[model samples]
Every structure is written in C-alpha cells, then in structure tokens.
Target: MHSINIHNKSGHDQTFEVHGWANNQNITVKAGQTSKIPAPDGSSGAIIALHEGHEGEQVEITKNGYGGNDFFDVSNIVGAGGNITAMQVGDQSTLKGDPHFMQDMNAAWHKASQDTRNKLKGFVFTNGQGKVTRIGPIKDSPELEKLVRTFANGKAYVGVGAWNGNPGNPDDNAQSSAGHGNKDILITYNDGDASPDLASPKRESRVAAFEVQRVQVAAAPPAPPANGPGIILTNKSKQECTYFFYGNYWNGNGTAGANFDKPMKNVTLAAGAKSHIPLPTTFKGRVQRGTELPATWVEFQISASNDGAAHGDISLEQGCDGAATIASTDGTNRKNGFANDVLKDAPAAACAKKPNGTKAIATTVGNWAAGPNQAAIDYLKKVVGQKKAYIVGGTGTDDVASKNKCLAVDMY
Candidate 1:
C-alpha cells in the first residue's frame, strides 16, 4: 500500500491511499491553499491535478482565487518514500512581453505532451505588434532549415545535398575512387529522372543562400569624478553633449582625502554644447598645522541646485609627502613614514611622488617585528607591563626566541 499526502495553503493536509493502478485522478484543493501528494509504497501509477501556470514550466497548486489553472502528471510516483509537495501558484503578470513569451515557449517545449507539441505546430510567432509575419513548422522553420542544409552539404546548400558522384549509397561513392577527379563545384541536379524533359540546374539551395547580419551600437560616456578642487561634469549620452557645473565643496573636516558630505549634481547637455565654470582653489578654514587633517583625495564635483539641474563631480587622491621618491601608487603601498610630517603632508594627488629630502613619517603606529628575535622582545615587553595582555606567535624556530623573551618578561 502507498500513501499520497496533499498540503494546501489553508493549512489543510490531505492524504490519499493507493492500493493499485491510479490513473488520471483529479484532486482539487481550494484557492490560496498548498497541497502535498506522497507516492504509494510498492505501487506505480499516474495522477492528474489542477495547478497554477506561470512564466516557465513551473506550476503552483492554488485554490479558486487565482486566475488560471494547469494540469500536472504524476505517473512515476511508485515505490518512493518521499511525498510530492504542492503550493499556491503566484502571479507573473509583471513580466515583459517579448522575451517572456519566448521563454514560456521554450519551457513548454521541454515539459509539453505530444498533443501540446502538435498544437504548438499551428501557433505562429510575432513581434510585439502581434502580426503573424513568421511562417512554417517549428522543426522545419527557416532558421532551423538553414542550419540543416549547411550540415547536409559539406559546401553548404540551401535545400538539398549535391551529388558528388558517390551514387551507390546516397552517403558514399559507388566505386570509392570513381569521383576522385570530380571538380569541387556546387551543382544542383534533379532529385530523380521523373522529370527528364528539363535538365536540372546547378545552384545553391535557398536555405544555404541566407546571410545573418549583426549591427554594432555605441556605448554611453562614463560618469564624472566626485572629489576635486574644480567642478567636473560629464554628459551621459552617447553623442557629443554639454553639462553645466555649479560650485560644490565638502561640508565636514576639509581633510585632503575625506569624502564630501554633500552629493554632486548633474545636468544633461545637448549635442555640441559645452559649459565651463571656475574652480575653488582654497578651502574655507585654515587647516591646522600640528594636528593631522583628515586624509582625503582631491577630485571635482558638480553642485546640487534647487531647480534640479544635472552637474558633474570629480575626485582625485592627494600626492605623496615626506619620503622623497616614495611610491604612493595604491592604498596598500601608501604607508606613513617616521614623523607625522611625512604622512601629514602627503599629497592629495593619487599615485603621486614626493620630491627628494622629504622627512619620513610613521603612517602606522603599532609595533611590528622584523627579525627572529623581535617576537621575543615583543613578548617580554608585554609580560613586563602591568596591563593584562595576550601573546600570539607564529610556528617557527623564531618562536623559541619569543618564548624565551616571554619567560624573561614573566609573560609565560
């Protein structure tokens, strides 16, 4: 005996017991309800149920509240310990029309019955306007027909294969060597001698003569930068366009690399138009000398306007300071030198270098180990200090030195 369980969205569970041969049995559940059907033990049968249809082959079990219904087959559920689950079908009305229909057809082809396939044969595809411009059977359609002809005739044919003098077997030569010296020219001949009055003309088939065309489109321009001294604007359109620039600045700590508080504005430009505006050279406050300013990169940005006009924004990193000939190409390499002067004065220009004779400033303040004995010294210092702390070490002979230092510092 096998058991089938059906669950509905209304929290109702229905179990059906199958003793044998259950075919096309219809089980109806309420709208907005989920159903579950389990396979019968030691029994093989097929069952049919109404479900909800969606964009793809997926079907949902729903009560009457939903719009459409679908049919599902469960013939292969015999001797299975698991139960088949069912749920209320959801709505798919928001999908775009063109691609969505195509996708639906593709899914239907995979899950369709023989009757469905035959019915689809009569259905025609059309553009969004709903005009039936395409014709022919699905398998023998112009698109697939062309591909088939190319595969049949080595040299590519429109409709049928050309005779290469290999007659005995339509696919092979009569005397294998008989057509060795035949010319490699495309020739079309009568399929048979039934119409002997007219000589067959040699020509490429219609299927083989079609050509595919591909067109290239231009891409849109990039967005303008966001942080710099001057207002930078960009046109988003593909054609030559102009944009307006308004005054803009970071509201917070005018640190050289900090992000601006306000967002930039952008305006559209007509083709062949250009807009120019003056940049702000100096920031509002006298940036203090001693305390380090917020690390900010410099770039340009357009100002926001009340009228809702578009503006461009640009931002640039400050140049390196302190160490002469320093490499500040990326964030990882831009470490602080010995004194605050080196890191503090680093340029706001990205990937920029400092002049020679600049002082070294320590960008990072934590203690780091260099040699094998360094870990030992670090451990000793930590243990000797009055503050509670943790000691971590890597696995290596150098770790012995760290252990010794920890013991000496009473950190062990």
Candidate 2:
C-alpha cells in the first residue's frame, strides 16, 4: 500500500510533513483545505517540510530568504553503496553557523544504544530571530572539519535521490537560471563522487518508497475576434460589378486559360448601390488576403462590363450572376448565387446560405462566393420572384441571383 496526495493549489494556508527514510516512518499533514498520506510497506525517501513564508518562517535554500516551499519525493529509493557513512546530528540550534547536513556513522550511528545515543541524536529548528537551532556531537566539530573539504567524494547520501536546491524566491521575471517555478531532483544510481561535501550529507539519505507528483500551472488561450465579423454588400443589380481582386486570380493561363478574374473598379451602381466589406477578424484557417497565395476564402469576379477590361480575365462562369460555377472546396464554394427564397423569415440555423433544398434560407455577404460584385448584384436586385443561379461554371439557372453575408451579417 502506498499513497500520498496533497493538493493545495495555493491561496495560502499550508503545512506538511511526510518524512520516511528507509522506514523511520512519519506522517503529519494538517493545514485545513487539503492533505493525505498512506504508506504501509514502502518508504526510503520523503521529506517535504516547508515554512518559508508566515508560520514560523526561516528556511532559505540559498540566495534570497523567507523559506517554506518544498517538494522532495525520492521516486522510490535505493542507491548509496560505494562507501556509505556520515554523521553530524543536529540542534546546535538548527546548526548552519556553517553546516550542511551529515549523519550515518558505523552502520547506523554505531549500533545505537546509549539511550539510542541520547534519543536518536539531534536537529531542532526555529530561526529568523525567533531563536532555537541545534546540531550535535557526532564528531567534535571544528566547523565540520573545513566543511568536510567542501564534500566531493562519493557515496554517503541522505535520500530524495540525494536532493539539491532551487527552493523558490527568484522574482523579477523568474530566474533560477531559467527553470521556471522549479523543483526537479531526479537521480537514479551510480552516485559516485557526489559533491556539496560535508562528509555524509547527500541530502540526508533515506529511501524505500517514493512517488510525489503535483504539477498545476496551465491556463491561457482565449483572445481572438477583436473585430472581424461585419459584412453587408447589397447591390440589387441594375448592371454594374467590379472591385474584385482580394485573392485567387491565376489568370496567368494554366488549365485552359481564363483561370479566374473580373470584378474590379468599374463603379456603376445606379440601381441599388451598397458596400461594407470587412471580413477577416482572424481564426478561420489561412488568411492574408493581399494574396500571393495564402487564402482560404474570398474571391468575387464580375463580368457584365468591359470598361474594366475584364479585370483578371473574368470567367468563373462568365463572371457570376445567372449562377453555375461551383468547383467547391467545401465552404460550398461560398454558397453560389443566393436569394434563397428571399430569406422567408430567416432562421434555419441562421442560414449561412448553401441549403436551398427547401428551408428557403440563404445569407452570406462579405466572405465571398455568391459571385460577381455589386454585393452579388444587389442580392439579385432585392428578390421578388424566380431566383436560383449557381455559377462557377454553370449548373442551376433560372435567372436572378446574388447572396453572400453570412457570419450572421455583422457588417460593422
């Protein structure tokens, strides 16, 4: 049986302890808001004591100050044998007048038994001005013999894979050398020539059962559409359409010439005139319409006027109007020539056009495809009767056509 779960997504109020180095056994998780622990037949490394900010502060891994930010889970221990033995015990008042942790003399404190060497040797803390720190006599120290030559000689560890540092407090745009919020001490075996010396303070070795996982930090993705869904092109055609070129004009001759182009600057609406085109507020697939290629929608070619010299060559079925040029790539070639029963009361999922198999709904303006400008011939001249033209190369015609203004017609 092995279990440990403590999730306090932080809002303050947290205190924990779960030590267990090779069965010394421990469990103390109390801080209202969340905590749990269970380990019956497993444990070799686990020490996560924190008090870094309020709650008796005083624990600084290095650099800044203010302690209490911890995480040590030896992922299930076992490693330390090339020459293991270290002892420094604690409580010269949480030691560290220049000390770094070391304990393990002669196969476990010399087979203990002097009252378990005076109640299992020392280590007591409470500093940051509140006083009270300790570290015992495992070897008449001289400042731990020059900090045991600043340790660097191998096999003597204390667990949590011989833990290391980076315990919070970096501010100013996060920088513990750039590992972010940081906490990752993972090592598995061949622990030779360790370091941080001090004889046997390999993070105070104790391993048997290990697995500690708590990672919460991810939330940012929601901002697009600041202004892009307005389109209304009504022109009820009286005979005039040009203002094309937004994309897809390969008229460079391939696939039998007239590849596509028309509709562009002729200016002659006298019958209904209306324009308000603005469709690319982002997030649809591939935009960049000033085009040299990048385009997922937008293409409106017109013909009924030669003054513009047939713009890009005009041909998507002789420049849209009486409909029939549908080569589609799914966006139903932009709902061909609209006027779907004049939107009889609208609504059919708000009609993005395309489906006139009878719910008589059809709408879509700026995002192109109703073909041949003047907002698709003024929506086929305000529709009063017989209308259904389908252009892109012909197929469904009975005369009168025009439609395109879908994104629910925002035009603003």
Candidate 3:
C-alpha cells in the first residue's frame, strides 16, 4: 500500500492511506485547506491528490475567496517508494494566475509548431509533459518505431528536447536538460524525400499567407492632333460636265501620282452645280489623306468639260483647256493658267496599266443594256478587284441591250 501526506500552508493538514494498487485516483482539499495521504512502507503504486477531492474520487476544482490559495505536498512513504506521479493544484482554477501544466504544455506545442513551420519543415506531433505537443517527429515512440528504424538505417534521426519556457529560444538555460535537451533531429524520407533543418525554437514564424492578383494593361488610342492634311473639292459649275482631278504626292522618293486614274461622274450642274469631292479615304489601303498625308508640298490639277460623254467627240471643253499643269507648288497655290489643261497634263506619263490580266474589246455598237460597261467592269475589277461580276438593268430595249454593250466596251 502507498500513502501521501498533505500540509496546507494556510488551512488544515490531513493524511490518507492508499491501499493496494490504484491508478488515476483523485484526492481533493477544501479552499484554503490542505490534506495528506500516507503510504505503506515498501509498497509501490502511483498517487494523485489535489486540494479538492478524496481518494478514489474525481472532481473539478474552482478557486474561492480572495487571497485564498490552496497548497498540496505529496510524499512517498513506501520503501522502494510508491511514486507520487502527478500533483495538480489550481489545475484549472478561475483565479487570475499562471497557466496550468496542461496549458503550459499546449502553449509550448503551439510555439514549437509555429517555429517549425516558419524556420523548418516536416515536424510532427508528440507527447509533451501532459498532452500531445508539436516537436520534431518522434522516432523512438512505438507509434513511430518503424519511421525511426527507417531513419536510423538511412543515418537520419530526429532528436527531441524537453520544453523550455521560451519555445523560440532553444539555448535558454531554463530548458530541462535532464531528459531530451534542445537538439535537431535528422529525419530521413522513405522515398528519397529530404527533411528540412530548422533554426532554434526562438526563431520567428516566417511562413506568411499572401494574396495574388492579376492586372491588365490597356493600349492607348492614337492621338487626334497628329492626324494628316485633308482636301475638300466643291463643284460650283452649271451645265453637266465631267471632271477629273489628279495630284502628285511627295512619297519621300519623288513625285508619285502619275500612276493614279480616278474619274468622277458627269455632274449635272443644272445652272448652279455644287458638289464636294473629298480625297480618297485611304491610299494603297494605308495612306489616309486626313490621317497620314502631311502638309508637305503637293501638286494638284482639275479638269472639267461640258461634254456628258466619259470619252467621246467633244464639241466644246471648258474649265480645262490647253494641257494639264501644276495648280499648287510647295504647299502654295501656283499661277492659274488653263486650269483645265493643268488638270489634264498634271502628269505627262500615261496611267499605270490595270493589274487585270485581260482587257475589254468593243464587240458591237448600238443601243445596249443600261448597266455597267466593260470599262466599269475592268475599272472595278482592277480597282475593287471582285472575282465575279453582276449587272442590273431597268425595263427598256435600249436599257436592257446596253447592259451587254456595256460589258463589251469600257462604259460606266
């Protein structure tokens, strides 16, 4: 049999005799009181007696009264002494005081885990002074014996140390050096995995949580002030007339407009004709008149005639007589001569040949379909470059017949 004697510093003193073998037995003392238990000499067993419950009893103890603290002192009275394995005083009392054994163990574990996660990798849970706590992987415990064996075979082992008051400071003299001291454990991976070496427990938890986001960059639009020069032509003439306008651009190499052939319709002025002719929106699919063309020197020419026919015998030709000439030089208006001649002879070279592989030949001459002529088709095919052609006509012998005639000769 085993016994324990408890002396209260401020209250009563009592004794208890624990017979036979008892495990996890609880003994309690009242508030501000003390109790004791006696053990048979030469007996061996474990005893746990707090200041709240009796032998073989289990109860939750709470602190009461101000300046009222209880004390418990356990001593083994048996030779080959029965052990006084555990003693819990103020274990979980509500009074403002230091944490209990369990809480200390938990705190140690939390500190260890945080330190390991930040400074080291691959830590596991182990039993601390009272409960499961975080530490280096346990290789010696039965549950981890296999892992330990494996690590040993691989010349790797994880060492453990008793909890120090400061988990981060592994070198603190406050640590229990009797059991396992502060040391690192080398854990070997079963499948060639590497273990991480951690710094001292006193290290800060460096593992941080972060957020990631994606940002998009938008492209800026073109500036409007940088756009190029523009030209607007207004026809203020009476009597239906056909006008042809031409211009030469400074393409960095030299003047390059003699190759373009743009024909305007026979605008019927009807005494006072007024029409605006804007330059082509784009040149060669790139050079926009108002977006790319600079205000550099350029030559312009305009040709006008009262004859309604696009190309035929002209009884009289107005607006443009003599020959094509320059209307403007070096961004300045030049002396106006036979302006129509200047328009006609703006360029001495003939217009570049249409890229179409074939040319139209007048098959017959008579009242024909009133649709686009071969010239229009060739022009459209050369300029617009449509692979197929379609002709629409109104009800009339001359109109319907003109469709086929137009297809034979160059007529719009």
Candidate 4:
C-alpha cells in the first residue's frame, strides 16, 4: 500500500532491493535518476535495502518498531556495516533526535513481540555538532545479534532515505534501511556540504550526480472552461464597435443602468483589435455583429461529445463580420455601422494581439465574452499533449491565449 521514492543524488549508481514483509526485488537507479518501490499486493509493509557505493558496506537502521508504527531499527547481518553518513525519515521530526519524535518513539518498541524487545532504537544520523550517534541495539550481545541476524536474513540490502557518502567504504551504504508502511518515503543522497536535515527544498544542493524523487500523485481539479474549444470573432477594421453578446447560458444584467436582456451590452471593441467570446457547453446562440445588417446573423451550437472532444456547427450567412452595433441598457436606441460576413467557420486563423480567456466555464454556464485585444481562434484539431495549438494572426494580430509557451508548444 505504501511506496518509497529513491532519489539517487550521488555521483555513483545505487541499488535498492525490496525485501522483508512487503516484497523482494532489486531496483537499480542510475545516477541522476529517481525511482519508486511499492509494497505490492495489498501487503501491510516491507523492508527496503539501499545498496550504495562500490563495496556497499553501510548499516544503520532504527530497529523493530511495532504494529502500524513509523519508527524502526536497522541491522547488518552480513559482513556489511557503517559507511553512509546521513539518513532522514518523513520530515525529520524523528531525526536529529527531535524531542517530539524521540519522545514517544521508544514506546513503539515495547509494542513489538518479546524477542524484538531486546533491541533499542534511537537516532541513526548525525546531530547538530556533526557528531554521528551510535546505531543498532544498545548492547550488542549474541542474543541480540542473532535476533538481528534472523531479521537480516543473512543478507544486507541496507537502506536509508539519504546518504552523506563514505566513498572509501563504498559497500557500507547497503547495510541499513528503515522498514516503511503506508506512507510515501523520499530518499535523496547528498555528498556535498549540506545540512543533516534534508527536509526543506530551499537548501537542496545542485551538485548531485543524480537524484530521485517520487512522482507525486494529486487529485485533479475540474476541466477548465478556457480549455473547451470556442469561437473568436476578430476585428481588423479601424472603427471601434459596440459589441452586444448574449445567449441561453447568459443571465442578463439587472443592474440599474445595465441592460436587462443581454449579458454583454454596450461592450466596446476598438478598431484594429479583437475580443475573446466564450462558448459554453451544449450551447445554442445567434451571433449578430451589428444592430442592423444587410442579412441575418450566424447561428451556432456545440455539444459535448465523448471524451473531452466537442462537436459544434456554425450557420454562416454571407455577412456576419464588418458590423458594429450601438445600443443602450435596454434593447432601445439601436444604431448600426458597416458589418462584415458572419457565415464561415473554417480552419482559418489570425492574430492581432494576445488574449487570455479566464477559466469560467469550469464552474457554471454563463454569458462569458472577452475582448478589446488582438486575438484569434483555431480548431485545435490535434494537440500532441495538453499543449495548446499556437495560432498566429499574422503581423498585426496577437492571440495570447492560444500561444502558451509555458507548457511546451505546437506551432501552427
């Protein structure tokens, strides 16, 4: 159920062998690489042995902690012991013998079976003065050694979540590893001058030959509205246009001076600029450019298809563009300017200026439209990954929303 993330931050390679109560398998992590080991098959827990250095001769573990306990001891049954100089568990609440972790930790030993009671557990890594504390049982008697040998199973797959490099005795890093249960453990080895507590991110040293960390799993949020495909009506003309936008998804403005019928009323679109108008899911609306026109406006609708794909159609007339509408809060005081064709939803795209569409559709269906900036729209037929398709509307235009270089790019 639990897993360990091994960060091989050392210059040399490292091998993590899964053994003990969980599973048995050897994972070799190349320098600069990160990997994971999981306790397979719904098992409660398992012992992870980290074999580091050329000769692999390190050993330092807390020892047999009881049921559901996070603290434990390590031993070297084989001829392997003491080379790795650093170790950390969780957030280091237990390392440096923090009073908090050290307080109730000794109690977990009492919870173990009687034979395991012979062992004593305490801090395994260096303290503030760089004084490395003693590891293993308090008294190394034959009985305790046999008990440790029984647990070691005649092999040392020793493991610690971190390392401080004992290059002379390369075989020592393999002598000790704390057993892990249901929590994710991260192990990053550091050889350079650094703090013994390797918990914080601010002090991470870049001089590692390699490092490994768990690929964190997080719950995903809802799909963003801007991620949904939509339509963009760009304006390249020199005359500023008053754009009125409304639809079934839009709840009309009821403010004192605001229009009561349409959601977007008396919105201004300057000449030579563009605006981003959002189309909601399962949408059906009529796009009218000017207050009056030579012909009727274009009607379009979109519905959610299987997966994240969508299917939509636009009823194009000869002229939906080239028009600017002028009106008041109510549907009165209507005036019109020269408008252009509106009936074509092809693969054509342009960019005058960039536009960033807010992710509003993720919450509710409402009248959403953005503009007064140079923008463009594209079909986004196939995105290699989640990277948005880059749509350039030529020299005079810009589409910021479609050109997100932060997450890689697919030029169109």
Q: Which candidate should be chosen as best, given TM-score against the real structure?
A: 4
Q: What lDDT is obtained when candidate 3 is compared to the true structure?
A: 0.21
Off by over 4 Å in 3: 1-3, 7-26, 49-100, 114-412
Candidate 4 TM-score, true structure as reference: 0.24
lDDT values, one for every candidate: 0.21, 0.24, 0.21, 0.29
Of 1 and 2, the candidate ahead on TM-score is 2
lDDT of 4: 0.29
Give TM-scores for every candidate, taking all chains together and pairing residue i with residue i: 0.15, 0.16, 0.16, 0.24
Badly placed stretches (over 4 Å) of model 4 are 21-23, 40-67, 76-90, 96-182, 188-412
For residues 1-412, what per-residue lDDT tens digits would candidate 2 score against the true structure? Answer: 3333433333344453334432534333332233434423212234333343211111112100001111111111121111111112211111121121222222233343566444533422223762323222212333322232234112221212111221211120011110111122211111122121222233331211111111111122222323233233434535553323232212111111111222222222333555544543221111111111111122222211211100111111222222212211112222223432334443344333222222212222111122123332344334421123322221223321121212211000
**Candidate 1 lDDT tens digits, 1-412:** 2123333322332223322233534455443343345432112232222212101111111111000111111111011111122211221211101112223233334454666445545433344664322223323344433322222222111222112211122221101111101111111111111111112343232111111111111122323222333322222223543222222221211111121122223344554333333344322211110112111111222221211111111111111122111111112222111112233433332122222323322111111000112232343223221111111111111100110001000000
Using lDDT, rank the candidates from best to worst.
4, 2, 1, 3
Between prediction 1 and prediction 4, the one with superior TM-score is 4
> What lDDT tens digits, residue by residue, belong to model 3 across residues 1-412?
2223232222333223333223434443443343444432222233322222323111111111000111111111111000111222221111111112223323444555454434423333334453433323242333332232232211211122112211222221111111011111111111111111121232132112211111111122212311122222222223343444333211111112121223222222332343333333222101111111010011221211111101101100001111211122112222221122222222222111112311222111001111112443233223222111111111110100110001011101
TM-score for predicted model 1 compared with the true structure: 0.15
Lowest summed-lDDT stretch of 10 residues in model 1? 403-412
lDDT of 1 at 67: 8
User: What TM-score does model 2 achieve against the real structure?
Assistant: 0.16
